[model samples]
Target: MTKFADIKGFVFDLDGVITDTSILHGTAWHQLADSLGVTWTKELGDGLKGISRMDSLEMILKAGHKENDYTQAQKEELAAQKNTNYVAEVDKMTPANILPGMKAFLDDLRAKGYQLSLASASKNAPRVLGKLGLTDYFPKIVDPASLKHGKPDPEIYTKGAELLNLDPAQCIGLEDAAAGVQAINGAGETSLGIGDATELGAADMVFADTSAVTLANIAKHLD
Candidate 1:
């Protein structure tokens, strides 16, 4: 068992965990698919969560039967276009875009002396954090540009721990996606899932939402 007090750092996922920008991302993806004449569905949008933009675009291309039609450069261009759309949406974000209880939870953790880092698959993570007025809260931000591989690869989470100068075992990774939970566990850190239990079964512990996350609940892991 690991105690919250024993945790030296906290790594958070940006999109679903810190904010509800997943919908904006999905909208961008859907719009991209529409322009490409590809059929898009909610199920496909779910697959994009926690994945890198290039990977998501690959998935979309494969689903659209255009994987072989585009060269790597073309794919990159399409991915960039998707990012432009997503960024347009994110630019409109404000502090109110942060999820319920997230600000207070982060403040509480900071007060307790826990180092914080943001490990997000989004290249726009810094922009989003700035829009939410949370840029100062995380001194270490491992975004898509910093990652060679995305979630479920564990590189991002491990990099986050490295940036905090803490061992993976000394950190707690908080996420709201199944792939992210797997990445956290794969990094040898404690996993705190922030969504559906069944969806995030790989997590060491699960909370239904940010409001359910508390120092006491996390400390109980020490037992």
Candidate 2:
């Protein structure tokens, strides 16, 4: 396997990776399922990895029944509800929910002269980072609001590279979703899949979770 030690920086996906919000996402998604009279199975939920909440909603509509679909307005409404519920859930997420080892990893990467940034499909990325005191770790944040499309399009990942003034191939993207992995792959960058390993088997490599993404692992990737 080709090691990507030559990469100059690291980009991260929020929510599941940094904020431990996957369960909350599932909660909101299952809520939508209830309203639609469909069940949000774990496998179906895992399939939504790396996709934006809006995209996930679209997927949910299809996964729920494939016949009943979400209109643009309803899509917006579902996204809004998820955001609302997520914020409320994390309003209490002071230091507990932030993944273990994230701070140390960020510090080590910054110390290693690697530029750090974030690319999340979540619309409330800025706010979520602020709540966890993680905003200072990454100055550049690419979210759904800044793009015409979400994950699996590479636009967000490409935009993050643009903001960093780096080429996509020169960076590594840390993501927890299948969509996130696909996005970085489409962007032509080295993608290190984090969060749930089963859902990210298609990635170049799958770590146990954010806690497993250490400087040691980063060093291994450094060519």
Best by lDDT: 1
Q: What clash pairs does model 2 have?
A: 5-221, 5-222, 5-223, 50-177, 50-180
Give a tens-digit lDDT track for model 2, residues 46-160. 8775455667877877776653565678778777887777678767667566888887788888887888888876666777788788877888887566689777889988988
Model 2, poorest ten-residue lDDT window? 62-71
Off by over 4 Å in 1: 37-40, 50-55, 58-72
lDDT of 1 by residue, 1-223 (tens): 6666678999999877889998898989999999999998878988887577889999998998889999999989999999899999999999999899889899998998889999887667888899999989988998567567766999999999999999999999999889889999999999999989999998999999988887887887556
Query: What is every candidate's alpha-carbon RMSD to the true fold?
Result: 2.4, 4.0
User: CA lDDT of each candidate?
Assistant: 0.89, 0.77
Supply candidate 2's per-residue lDDT for 219: 58
Cand. 1 TM to true fold = 0.86
Runs in model 2 deviating more than 4 A are 1-5, 28-82, 195-199, 221-223
Model 1, position 217, has a per-residue lDDT of: 78
Question: Relative to the unseen true structure, what is the C-alpha lDDT of residue 121 in candidate 2, on a scale of 0 to 100?
Answer: 69
